[model samples]
Target chain A: MSKKLVEAMADLEEDAVLAEVKALKAQNVPALDIIAYLQEGMSIVGKRFEEKEYFLSELIMSAEIFNEASQLLGGGMGGAGSSKYGTFVMGTIYDDIHDIGKNIVTTVMSSNGFNVIDLGVDVPTAKYVEAIKQYKPKVIGISCLLTTAFDNIKECIQTLEKEGLRKDIKILIGGGPVDEATCKYVGADHVCKNAQETVEYSKKYMGV
Target chain B: MKTNKELYNERLTRIKKAIALEKPDKTPFAPMMDSFCARHMGYTLAQFCFDVELSNKIMIDSIKDLGEVDAASGTSSFAGGMGLIFMCRVKLPGRELPENALWQLDEQELMKPEDYDTIISKGWQAFSNEYVATRMNVDFELLGKTGAFAPIADQRMREAGYPVYGGGVVSLPVDYLSGGRTMAKFMMDIKRMPEKVTEVMDIIMKNNIETMKAGLKAAVDPIDVFIAMARGCPDFYSTKIWEKFVWRYLKEVTETCIEEGIAADFHIDANWERGLDYFKDFPKGTCVFETDGMTDIYKVKEKLGDIMCIKGDVQAGKLTLGTPEEVYNYSTRLIRDMGPGFILAGGCSIPPNAKVENVRAMVAAAAGK
Candidate 1:
């Protein structure tokens, strides 16, 4: 039954996942066990996404289904599923309103049992520094889709360094304009092409 | 060491030879003129886009400053059709959004799943009119104005002896539906019902073929139309998905043009390395594969250079931000690597914000200046 639940999540069948979670709860399966099954499904989704078999839409849909299942299971057990993969703070930097990529990274991160705080688009550098102080996340990701925002990304890294927050957390940058050159220019530790790669890097960072 | 006319013909010959996959003395340069005209005259994009006559005048006048080139400038008529743009919910720079912001199309599913049956049966034009009425909520006046600008630019460019390639504005069904269904929803639809998607694609292709035939009849001989495949790259979907949904329709469109003896030049946007294997299928000497610099043009040359003509590799980022020397170096590198069939151009439209000197540098480098 747990394996079937994983399959449902992997298939991105939101309704099927909800029904399976409900059945498992009714049958007295441990909430932790259900959460484990969902994570396994997420791993499969990640693999498919990395392999180019699945795309951004499928990755997002799978995350939504997992969210629904987690909520259903949590409601029955009187608590939410706990994330052991640590925390992440991510956002699209200032002057750039694009967020589809950032949102996908957030979903993938959260689905992989990482607590993600999505700061949203057009985020100021100061807000990032503040979020870092407040959340103390293990990872900080900044996204910029526009060529104009390249300088702002560099400014963000400089701000982090000035605040002495650069040493504590790993910084990641991603977007259409961001390549290896931009990554190096902005002084980011890593450049992620997509959400799947971001999740993989986060897993390795968290050493899980 | 040539007069403007002599230089112009020299460049045209180089471009023509390259398109035919024959070796030329030098690589030809055809810069993708997007917003460069307005900026050249120190006018806002809003001014350039809305005033067709003014934009045309600026393009004609600016060619002297823009230097010797095979063709003049052009962009999608977003300005000429502001009413339709707003009605269609398409975003624009300095108008519906910010002054300096780039114009963009909002990828919302303006059409729903049930609309598929209507499109399949009602046909493309009827459904297009319906879409304008329902989705755009406006009459065809603005859209007509937008289209009207194309001829003025085309006529003026030809009269000036710098013939513009009418990037044949036909979208494959999947590409067309991508706008209506939005990319994400359409992708989902493809996954959910491949058969239904294929059915609609057949309708779209038939409509597109008719459009192509009409265009061929309207234009003079040496009929080359730039196929706007900007959103048709393999990056958005898997290779298999691209084959199933995009390639079949694209092949049909290409075949229709080839059978009619028209040159089908393709303006393919985005990185299409994953699907470069499919380019081998296109009939040789009949098409020019114009790229937006995201794909490795050199890699493509190594893979499919012998099969079809290829042009591009200058990036918008480099043009907008990089120095003139960088532009010169990149242009020279493209010429050195893929010279014979190469037409020097941006991998995509030269962004409106491109520096004048940089634009000049690209043209100069192409001319071996």
Candidate 2:
């Protein structure tokens, strides 16, 4: 049983993990059984990405494997055995079009089961407001690859303040040219250290 | 009587001799390529970065703009559009631009080898396999050009007062961090995982080699020009990083260009200071190192000597804000200092929105008027 747990968590193979998770049902596995199994794997991958034990390439690979496993779990769930979730809206601000980092975060979030809306690049403050009004999401994720567009994040915050929505939505930022200082200076509530941290933080913040 | 090419070449030689701190025909004067000058001549920066017809026109016009200078030149991107993401609107004064974060599906993960093939083969090779070059004759010219490029997103740095157009891969943590992120990670990796970082840099070098290899073979005139192929300006990269990561690899690429009989220049946009020793073993030829801002061109003249020509050092910010006469005076001073082993140019990429007439006057000053 210990070996099975280790095998389940240590396996970075997408289909193999999914197969193992699926075959557990044939053996009359409990919901707690699969949840506990997948959660271990998530933790491992997340830690690797965070501790610098993994590269973006490997982190991405692990996420993909986890996604495959997630499909098996999401589909096989009985009505009472449902997972709780959170939503994140991500994008680059107006006049700045850089998305590699944010896109990675969005993928991890969606695969990890957060409802994520990607407002494509060159987004202005108004669009972010409109999205928040529509989604009423608790978290707003912003990514910028250019220093010039740094203001967009602050601009969005200012806009939210004007709309009296600043107190409600938490802002999260990450990207090549931005950092924790930028996150604070730009007035974000939180900033993920990297992809895995993005998932872990999103889960914790999302109450998932 | 000395022939015109001989006369031109001799005049250049004299400037070269003077730059060597030897006697020569007074000082060498040369003007760099400029857009605002072209715009003042009625061409736009957008038109300059793109349309080569206009770009070539501007290049030729620069000769007339700046008089009897030694080596005349400037930067224009005739073929650069890969990796950068820009969406074009075919409207009045149409603007094509990079899309924001929403358009990316990068996932900070492995693209699988198959995706790599798809991306690498995006241009002519794929286009040929998919669509016959039907536009070869009249049909081709009718279809306006579409090019792929590493996306050039714009920016305004914290220190920079205004939003400036700048782009060249940044914000890639996993890409960078898979090695070691913080100083701690780097030190730890150096002690424990020497092979890991070396392997990563090796991969980077290989990619750079292949990329530049294709560029070397891409027989086009403007491309015969290698821009920013200047890494390791000392300001952005440390001497350690420069020695370890940049130097050898650039040497190899530059060697390949030299072997190919192509003209290449290293465009350094930062103040490199007295690190001339770093570029010593770089591929030798008529290799030119282009700099912007307060790069001591005279010192560079002494250090590199005639080994490699220095290209530019006109401070763009100062030039843009200063008077035409001030521009002329500076141009003259630089000409005297730089002599023949250099080309007069903007210290960096000329801002898209710079004064035109000032640029023209600076050019005239370089022509020995």
Candidate 3:
């Protein structure tokens, strides 16, 4: 039954995954055990993505199924426990409200076992400072779709430096317009081309 | 000295020849710029968004300043029409944001799942009218004002010796639904209720094609219709899902454009290399593939150079962050390598903060300086 659940999740068979989750729960499987299976399935999904067999749509569908199946397990994935990897803090920078990229990264990060702190869109620099102080994430991501927000990202990173929070955490940036030039301009440690890159970067940073 | 009328004709000829996959006298520079014009002209983004006449003047003047440009992708823009195009509410600069901030789309789940049935029953036009008025909070007056100014802007560009490329804008139903329902939810709908979504899309496509044909018929000297397809990039979907949801409608729209005797300017954003081969089905010289720098343009040339005219792809990052020499070198390389059927343009639109010298370098490269 567990193998069926994992395979269903990997194949993005939403109904089958839900049915199996319910069956497993009826069989008195622990919520943690069920979440482990889902994660394993997501691992397959991610590997497919890296191999180009899947794409962003598949990642999104797999995440949605995992979330739905987690809901069926009584407590949500949030209640599963702390991630083995450390927390990740992220948001779209100030004056940029685009959230699709940011949301994708956070969702992929959460499914990949990082506790993500999504500060939401149009996030002020102070918010990043606050998130860093509280979450103490090993890596942070700043997303910006607008060229106008580049200066704001620069300012956000400068604020982190001023607040003495810049030394510990690696700052990564990504979005439509961002590139290595943007990474340099914004003083970020790296630029992720997509969500999977974010997961890989954070995982490497966390040494997981 | 040549008159502006003579110059306009020459430029138009150059652009048309490039689209027809013929070698022109020189490569045409047809950069798409909007907010960049506002900043170049020292106007606030708020002013550019709200004042159509000023926006038109800014774009024309900016193009003129970039010497030897053959055409412009678009001449005027209105922030209000953004909501209609994207099917979401827009947060305009100076209204919900700072006086000079760039306008943004405030995407939310404004169109519920049941709205698909509404579209099926009421039709896209009737349903969209009610949805925009009730849910989108679009300023109809502003839309009207911009609508009134677009012709004037096109005329002004012609008078300034530049041919405007895009006749009108059309979008896929998938893009509309994605914007209205938000991407995540819409992607979910494609999984959970694929049939219902396709039904709604078919209804919307019928109306959209009719509207596009009507707009093209009414257009004065229509050339190519801009078909926005960023949201439907194959990078975001599996081969099966993309073929069914995105390519079907996209092909239909492009076929409609071909049937109507107008070029389809595909304003494709994001990376579309995975689906580049799909464009091979189109007849030679009937389409223009305008990519936004994400897709490797060289591969586009390698695959579709004989089939379609290629425009674009000086990246936004390079324009905003790199120096004039880099821009000049890149543009010169493109002109040298990708010409005959090539039109030089910024990847999508020039970023607002792109250096004036860099833009000048791009034009100069095309001018063979």
Candidate 4:
């Protein structure tokens, strides 16, 4: 790693994005450079999670940290051209607004450079379609915390399918209500266990 | 022919005797208030939760409707800022929000001690400014009298992202204020300075003496009842954490209640599977413990008998989805099996949409009047 990369890694470990941005700005490290450093940090978190060095609690915190850093950067960092990552529409699905997990996903996606548009909670199916038509998100992440509304995901996926947008949208499902069968039942392209996994799986799903 | 003092003493003795579970003027049916049932009385959950005036109206109306519920209390969430996530209720199908979802603040983003203090000052304002109405059918006045809280602290750390039940018990408001500081930075501190763990707890109860004195002023029945509720939850860092982080503070709180002659209750439903041992330590009758779906309240008969009131039996969903027959059978069986010692309540708060018929059935089943 170069000196700039080493310094960026140190800032990432500090979990201080504002400080990281300041250092980067001082060093003339562009927004993409900071994002790559963030990606490296997240990968480390994911590896630690796989090694059982971190827990769900830590995963969320890390994801949230990344989100705060990205929010600070806003749209000013990528220099010229499109976002170095992509775009995503994420939410707690319709009727199940438990955002701790959803927010974690949003943070990780944003940290990975995805412009995540959080539709908020209890988002209706039409809203997803409208957002897709509006922003053309590369993927759609649906979250839920209620066991009672587990079946609603099927509605969300099917609406996309009916609208002939299923082929275009990569539907990722997660949260307490998500299970292996649920992931398969709702035709989700990927099932994520935590925020790190969500970001990792989205990368795989997006073939990035 | 009886002396005036003798008669006055006798009546007082009778009431005391009744509360002590010996004998009294019939059985005292102090049914804990269920806010989920308040919707049946025609109040929005938003109105019932945030505004005290509306909550009191729903309470008055519900108590009036049941004509059997003895207590005028409401749900507890004073410190839990999980309601903030409720701002996103627009994302779900039928637009339903998940129950008790918490706002898991990012650990790494926790403000430095100085910045946190600044946020703490402004956070209270942020909390007030961020309040949104859930439009739930309920009342406000009755809500206040019974301790329905305004999100003073967003204690979501224990409930969310932690994969565990939490226990929160402190003796003083000042201690609680200080404890909030310790908790907000707990994760970061734990990782960065693992050796300072004991000091973390030191900061939690530093002003116990004054806090206990304040606890005296806020007495209603007692804070012990609320403690019983906490004892039943799961992710509270285990029984060990309880002993280290909060037991002494609770002891101070419970001890104060004892000194003031006020009754208290403890509730820690859902993850109370191993809580029986914790129940054994409580000074009998000083408080009550409520459990939920995963617990067997009957175990208390053998271990916790005469120790504390063990309430909760009807499942929130059963009371919502089950027929009146099912609710009646569930309540009657619990009241009879748990006997006269326990309270008959939902395993947790009854849902806002719970059917009224089911609530009435449970009340009738418990009282049999």
Candidate 5:
């Protein structure tokens, strides 16, 4: 039944997944087990996305469906107990308001059992520093869609370096305007073109 | 040295052969000239966008310097004057954004879900007029001054033996909603109220056909409309969802273009390796496919080269930051790989900051100079 539920979520059949989760719970499946099933489904979705069988909208849909199922299953599915992979600090940079790319990275990362602290859009350098200090996460993701934010990324890296936080965390940058040249210029540890690459990079840094 | 007319004829023949899926003397080059022209002429991008006379002059000068190319180019970005006259959602230079930043269309939900019924009832024109009146602040008199250079620019290019290709417009149902109500809202609509999405899409399909028809009339003979397939990539949706929402409208639009004797070229972005099958449905020799470097142009050539014209895709990053040697090497590989049926252009809008030397290297390689 749980495996079937995973298939439903992976296939992006929203109602079927919802109905299956409810049915499993009605039969007295533990919330924890249901969460596991949901995670398994999301894993498949991520794999499909990485393999190019799925795209952004499908990924977003799967995330949406997961959130819906999790809400139905209740509290234990997210946050500390659910997170096995360490936390990540993520945000679009100060001047850039685009968040779709950031949101997808956050959602995909969190679904993989990484506790992602999304700082929302237009996040200032100081806010990122504060989050890094608070979360002390192993990975930090900076998303910027505009070319103007190229220098701002450098400033963010400089600020982290000044505060002696640069060496501790792995920073990955992604967006429309970012490429290998800009990635080098911004001084990030890595550059990701998509959410799947971000996950792989995060895992690689953590040696997970 | 050859006369300008001789140069123009040579370039035009190259483009024509590529479009017809035949080998040209060499690969044709049409760099996606954007804000680069403004900067090339020692003017700030702001001066280029706002000053009509100066903008046109800079365009003429840039082409003259680039020497021979297949087509006379224009800035792909919409004129900044539109933003000034109308309360447009587009961010323009010297306005809400820095003078150097490219003009960007804001994807805000200016229309709510409730507006769907209103749009369906009133029709696109009436709805659009009302939407524009309520949504944008319009000053037609000021807007008229924005294009004092357009006619003169066209004439000057022709006199210089450069013929501008007709500007093509494409409209996807979801894109119309994305522009008006923002992508986020429209995406939510697709999930939450799918039936309504389809209903609205049907209306948009008819409206888009009308738009393409009008474009054919407005364009030069042998009209080819460059389909703006922005935000309609395979990455954005599941295959099931894309077939339902996007492909249907796209197919209908292409059919209209073909029936009207207008050829279609698309500006496809994102990694759409699995979605190449969609191109197969278009009749052979009826269309051209252009990619934005996200989808591998090599793979595209391998698959569709015999059937349709293929243009594009040098990486924007390489153009902007790489050395001329690097640009030359990459351009050579693309030419060698794509052979005939290829027009060398940036994968998308050439970034405003691309070095002139890099641009020259691309053109020079294609020209065999």
Candidate 6:
């Protein structure tokens, strides 16, 4: 592990992080090892976020830097198989095309070691069920910025229960208008106030 | 019964008094609603999005049903106008999705990094006109029809005994650029080219201020200007970054409002507990700190109660999912604890699926029954 690479990534020194990735590559560092260092750096970023020393800006910046450095190693960090944490399925519920919140959660989740399956915005209930049957993720996040989509979320949760898939995984809901009342109304397990909370909740659920 | 004109004058006085931090006889109910009004009047979302006159009629009818509303933030809405506010494309209910679906902003990286230089060189109006024409996929005929109908809609609301609260809407440069560039890419741009971003923002702010001043001058009843700043909330950035990019411009815009003899209604979304103190510097009675439920409303009252009028924070979830009794009790508590200078409103816009009885309960709370 290169302490410099980890520190550079954690500090969000883009140039330094990129330079270190190239230097380590020149010295024949294995791609997986470099990816591990980058993940370690992201873990530190998450820590700073939890402590409130860094905010969403830092998290996005850190993720951008991590992706750039990963590209230097021939882009092998794309799949769920390489993740240390279990898979996470995420989507914006049906009829809600707002994707900023969903994208943020997925990006932060990916940077924090979860293999995130982003179902994209306006995702229907059947799509979510298909993803669950295929990926069998331990946690799933549903995002909805419109209050109109609340029933859709409730219906989605009910469908999961009907399919006997609700017992095995945790369901988290979030977005601009969602609250504790929304969580109860939608039958979601928890309502994440921000991306960091999503990461923390998923980590605890996964025993990571 | 008082004439509608008399009622309009009385309500306007009450709202203005609240903004000036003086106690009116009663707390005002100036709800900011759109889709909720449509749904309340038994119109589909597609009907509301397609017909501006129908939207106006729905808003008027819904406000009348609520009873004792002092004002509305707006009595009509055009989905096409959203492209201007968000600086991106919108997928209308009838056009892009199911007919009854709520409209959504299709945020993508529509504005490139080089577009900042284009904005700086050509001014916001020129660049934005072209961007809307070419990039936003908006129908020009619909845009024109809606644009022509706005004043008429405002007039109809005034005729129906409701004074409108905000004359026009403005946004921080970051909101437009972030929506155009997408939040992640804009945040990256802030880091990659801080100086250029700062330069571009300065140009945009100048253009916005000029347009705002002109609008205020042109309005027969310019009570306040709605300043949308959800994306620039301090929750999204550290103190240093927020102070530089968000707060600096916010302070400037508020100061401009103060100078222009109008109030600045900050349509703040998301959690903003960390940045409440920054608002303290604005002169007392010059601004309204409107929050969605994400930020603790009680904290706002505790900190800026004596300084500015606090509007809002009936959470959308409560209005949609909770019972009428719950909404009544919450809104009554808000009026009790945060009033003397409080204007009751939804956290942001009332959710389209909100129960009609829940909204009536909120209005009844403001009416003290």
Candidate whose lDDT is highest = 6
Q: Which stretches of candidate 2 lie over 4 Å from their true place?
A: A1-11, A25-36, A72-88, A95-97, A106-127, A130-139, A146-155, A168-208, B1-51, B55-255, B258-369
- Which of the numbered candidates is closest to the native, going by highest TM-score? 6
Per-residue lDDT tens digits for candidate 1, residues B8-28, read: 566556666787788888777
CAPRI quality of model 1: acceptable
* lDDT, residue B257, model 5: 76
Ranking by DockQ: 6, 3, 5, 1, 4, 2
True-contact fraction in model 2 equals: 0.00
lDDT of 4 by residue, B95-143 (tens): 1323322212211221234433343445433422332232221123433
Candidate 4 regions exceeding 4 Å error are: A1-37, A43-57, A68-89, A92-98, A104-117, A121-126, A132-208, B1-38, B43-57, B67-70, B74-264, B267-287, B291-310, B313-318, B321-341, B364-369
Candidate 5 lDDT tens digits, B1-369: 878778767777777777877788888887667587877767877777666667767777887788766775452224543332222366566876677766655446678888888877887677777777677544344356555545666666666766565555666776677666665556667887888878877987787677767766765434367676666776788788888988888888888777876668776866777778778877776787877777878789878877788778877777776789998888888888886777888777676777889889888888776
TM-score, second chain, candidate 5: 0.92
Q: What TM value does model 2 have? A: 0.48
Residues A73-156 of candidate 4 have per-residue lDDT tens digits of 664222212445677888777656455557657755655556678887768889988989887877888987544445577888
Candidate 3 docking quality: incorrect, acceptable, medium or high = medium
The local lDDT score (0 to 100) that residue B172 gets in candidate 6 is 93
Q: Provide the overall lDDT of each model, using Cα atoms, as 2-decimal numbers.
A: 0.72, 0.51, 0.88, 0.51, 0.75, 0.89
Span of ten consecutive residues with least summed lDDT in model 5 chain B: B79-88
List the candidate numbers ranked by TM-score, top first: 6, 3, 5, 1, 4, 2
- Model 2 chain A: weakest 10-residue lDDT segment is A75-84
Model 5 stretches astray by more than 4 angstroms: A1-55, A62-82, A94-97, A121-123, A146-149, B1-6, B75-88, B136-149, B221-223
Judge candidate 3 at residue A24 and give its lDDT.
85
Clashing residue pairs in all predictions, respectively, total 4, 27, 0, 56, 4, 0
True-vs-predicted CA distance for residue A53, candidate 6, Å? 1.8
Q: Is candidate 2 or candidate 3 better by lDDT?
A: 3
- lDDT, model 4, position A35: 65
Candidate DockQ values, in order, are 0.33, 0.04, 0.76, 0.06, 0.36, 0.80
- State TM-scores per candidate: 0.86, 0.48, 0.96, 0.55, 0.86, 0.97
